[model samples]
Target: MEEVQTQRESEQETSDESAQSDQDDNQPIVSPPTQPEPSYPSERLKRAAHMLFFKRGRVPGAKAWELKAGIGKSYEKVLDQLDEELKELDLQVKKVEAGGIGEYSPEDDEADKFRYFVRLRGTLTPKEARMSGWRIDNLAALAAALSLVVSKQGKVERKELEIMIAEKAGRWRTLTLTDTFLRTGYLEEDETGMISLGWRTKAEVDLPSLMMLVAEAKPQDDDAEAPATSSMEESVPQPSEEQSTE
Candidate 1:
């Protein structure tokens, strides 16, 4: 009877241990939460500076004053922060000296030409402004017009070009064929009213490879019915077995 009781006690202990192991396996695992993304103040200031410089074309002083009035920061502190960011981006601050400045104005120059009556100043050339890929319609029209001029062998009458472009592309396009070519530096008109490619267009002149290929294929098509080689080939000298033996 004691042996049976001892056996029962051992079995009970084993069952309790198995139950504890099952509970441990069923326990949920808890992990640490992820940290949120950090925002950099310097990066924000750099973006704001670039906007001021390129978009507004304002000097540092004017930009700082605008920022202070608009965003509630002192001009001096904003300027210092802007300067630090500009240094990090490898941009230099240019100071213009003028007599008694209430508001700074760009000086006039004889060489400078206005586009659509807006005066462009400081470092940004007219070509650069046009080439900045900002005007898609202008670029497309320019490309199409220049291509028509080049394909027509360096000179295309303006009216003829307009008709062709209207048929090829569509009506309601903003740029005229002449305006397009003018913008792209491809076509120019003389005083006598003859339109021709400009210097830049002349520089790019070459026989287009596609045109050359088409020209070559034309002769082959014309001669398709003719014999492959000349009849004179039979009269040409050929070494025979008898000649080799001699």
Candidate 2:
């Protein structure tokens, strides 16, 4: 009887150990990473900066509901914070009046909206202004593509633009340039796959200035080609009048 009782006690202990082991296996092993709540102003500033960075065109600044829907907070506060941040970078939010291009009219409010325009602090070269935040090679490719479109009266077939770029850099490079320009707001595409100047180009680039730069660049390109052409001509054996007679 003593031996049977001891055997029953051992069995009970084994059963308890198994139950504890099952419970431990069912429990979660790893805790999730902690994410601290950001402050109110920081959240607002983050939204504004995000919009400015990613938005391809002008961001509607005056509409209260627009901000509320987009950022889930007050737009006025966000704009103020954004403006302050931009000032640190020598940039500013520009206010365009109503009836202007890309204007936004809110319900029951006819106030003008602000456009993201980086106001230059002082005299800066075009290359300097653009290269501050943009890739230099991409900018050059953009200029080349834009020149082609602008020469064709503000629009060009996508294939034609690609062919022109491919001449300088291979087909793969042309494709990359096209994608980068479209993403950066320097170019836009239509339903027909037509390429043209985008909203950012319309806002920032002056047409006359661009034309002047293109005009200046043409002479340099021609000068570069002259030497190559002259060399090729000299390499070919010309049939002289004496040789023709012989």
Candidate 3:
């Protein structure tokens, strides 16, 4: 009886050990903790500045999507940084609607509808403004084009535009400069040859301020400025006495 009892005790001990072994085997594996990604590189701001200041393609500046793809999803943060830096240099980073001029809401930034530009932070002196590479006639043509479009409530037929610019800039110069404006995005031309303000104009110009200055301008003897001023003054709408009272 003692031998049988001892053998049973040993068998019970082995069964207990086997159960513990199965429990150990069934335990879930735990991995080491993963770390989060590091902060973006510091050079992203520099990359953003280069992208903004240079015209590398069909347009003057970079699309928001392009900057996001090349830099990061937080590319606007870098742009904000760039804008701050530009303040000292009298320049700024501006984003405008890509296709046409309208009410610009930065709330739409996530949708890739914006293009960024670097432009003067304040108005340039006339001498400094003339230093820009465009010819005097071309600049006059653009001013006239914008004025005519605004006069017509944001659109004008291409022929009407050509004629208006021609009145100031001459016919041969008008055609060439109008094409340049369309190509460079100061004005947009559709398949129907209807003209309207473009992304560049929206980004760089404040039309209401422009109209006000034109309306207030005294005619100058300088031929280039005179034509642009007179044409703009004629086209710019005036506030009626009733609206002014209000």
Candidate 4:
């Protein structure tokens, strides 16, 4: 009778275990709570803006590698985001060594070799340029210089360029400003004394639009009241801007 009692108790415990197992099987699983993804892009973008807009060290722009280190993986997307943000402010992000980048993705495996900058989306009005401390003679000299270089297939003798700019500006001013451009990275001079567009110019200037504007610019017809249209404004591939009469 004691042996029967032991067997009965063991059977009862087994039945209880089976019921508990069924209960556990029906219970819902509760996983650990997950953390939200961090939004680092906005903060990274601010860093990028400061790097591009402000002069750091000896340069006015930042390199892809520098930006990548500070912005994280595939930082070009952050630049794209910056570009979008800039459009509203009449500015845009540009990358040098990216010829015709508008038609395709300018970023590449060798992107680190390129540099990034911020530039005006629209041509600055004459008043704006002047108020920004731009002398008309200097502006004319620059327009003449870049236009001559572009017309010469992007390579010209240094002396020839100086002479071309001298036609717009005096010889002394030409020498002074040429050095300025060279030091500032707008024009590069090789050992052979050939002048070509520098990395900074490639980053900031639109060669095609510049050339077109120079080619199309002519003296306005003798009708002051005839609504003199600005060829510079028209040639530039942007929205029309009202001309500023100085």
Candidate 5:
């Protein structure tokens, strides 16, 4: 009777341990956290616009938003707000100039009215335009340095030119200017610190080429410096040594 009682106690203890182990094994596992979904409509619209800008180089049309919105009634109001924001950035709705005899109306009732388009404009001088277009901030200094070299007939003290540019443009660092010059293929520095346009750089670009690029760029109607296409061709730079070698 005592042996049987001891055996029964051991079996009960084993059963409890086995039950606890099974419960532990049955517990669900937790996964790593994920990014939260966007909570606001405007944020979603902005994300959509950014995506469209990167993919197609412009904003999406009203029709596109409608399709994306999937027949949602808020599309018109959302698109209007988006247009207002885009206008602040100098982008506007692309309008068709003329409609055919049976063409669709320009009102919201017509599907064709929402066709999207964008115009890109630059707000800088010809030399400045290149820098601005490429988003290079040290452009003014590089242009000034290049101008100095060209004006002085292809030779300039690097320090003096940098100082001149700083004086003219106000408080730009030497390293930043130097980096810009190198990146843009505009100038080079020697071990003595004297600066000049590199042979390869000089071979590729000259004052005439700069003038031609300026002339070829689309200018505002009121811009006095805008040159004609014929004048632009005339401004083409003479072939450099690299060009001759080729």
Candidate 6:
């Protein structure tokens, strides 16, 4: 009886061990903890970012010294550091000259300097547009005006644009929309008063995507013909019964 009891106890222990082994096998495996990302730059860099990203009026960006007091320090280094932080989001702070490289004159005491501007890794995607704090209407107007400019192959006559907008939203809205585009640096007026695509359009707006969108746009239905046909019918006096009989 002792031998039989001992064997039973041994078997029970084995079963318990097997059960624990199975529980361990059923448990989920845990991965190692990931390292945290580095922190953003100082308040001055943050301020620069705010101005570059949020301020649409100041295209290309503001002066480095104007951003903060520490002009002597490595401003470029700080901008590069900020760009590294923004890299995760596919954005960067690019240093742009005010009016092209030729415009930079060391001879002049007050010549234009490099300005820091915010740009995406790729073209200005809809995601960037939404993130840039632009209103829906603003974007729509831009798209419309840009489409016209693109269709014209770079420039659209101001008079033609005014007429087009006047037909839809009246003359006042045309002025407002055009002025807004101009102010935002998306449109530039040439000496001839023609509205052309601005420098920022090239910098920010994706030309390829713009062309593709314009190409894929659905054509408006031929409702003009319907209006014309109805007007012609009304203008043609109907034949009277006596005239018809004759």
For candidate 4, which ten residues in a row score worst on lDDT? 98-107
Best by TM-score: 4
Give lDDT: candidate 5, residue 111: 45
TM-score of 6: 0.50
Give TM-scores for every candidate, taking all chains together and pairing residue i with residue i: 0.27, 0.47, 0.64, 0.65, 0.29, 0.50
Clashing pairs for model 3 are none
2 or 6, which is superior by lDDT?
Answer: 6
**TM-score (C-alpha, index-matched) for candidate 4:** 0.65
lDDT tens readout by residue for model 4, 98-197: 3322212545457666678899888889899899886878877877888888888889999999988886788778899899788767788888999988
Clashes of 2: 0
Ranking by TM-score: 4, 3, 6, 2, 5, 1
Q: Which sections of candidate 2 miss by over 4 Å? A: 1-89, 95-133, 221-246
Task: Give the better candidate number (4 or 5) by lDDT.
Answer: 4
RMSD of each: 19.8, 17.0, 16.5, 14.0, 22.2, 9.7
Better of 1 and 4 by lDDT: 4
lDDT of each: 0.51, 0.68, 0.82, 0.79, 0.56, 0.72
**RMSD value for candidate 1:** 19.8
Model 5: ten consecutive residues of lowest lDDT? 94-103
Put down candidate 2 lDDT per residue, 1-246, tens digits, no spaces: 999999999999999999999999999889888997334567667766666556453533333445556776456566666777677677666443333333555643543243444344334577785758866665666777888888999899999999988876677798888887787667888789998887566555666776788787744467788999999999999999999999
lDDT of 2 at 18: 100
Angstrom error of the Cα, residue 14, model 5: value is 99
> On TM-score, who's better, 4 or 6?
4
Candidate 1 similarity to native, TM-score: 0.27
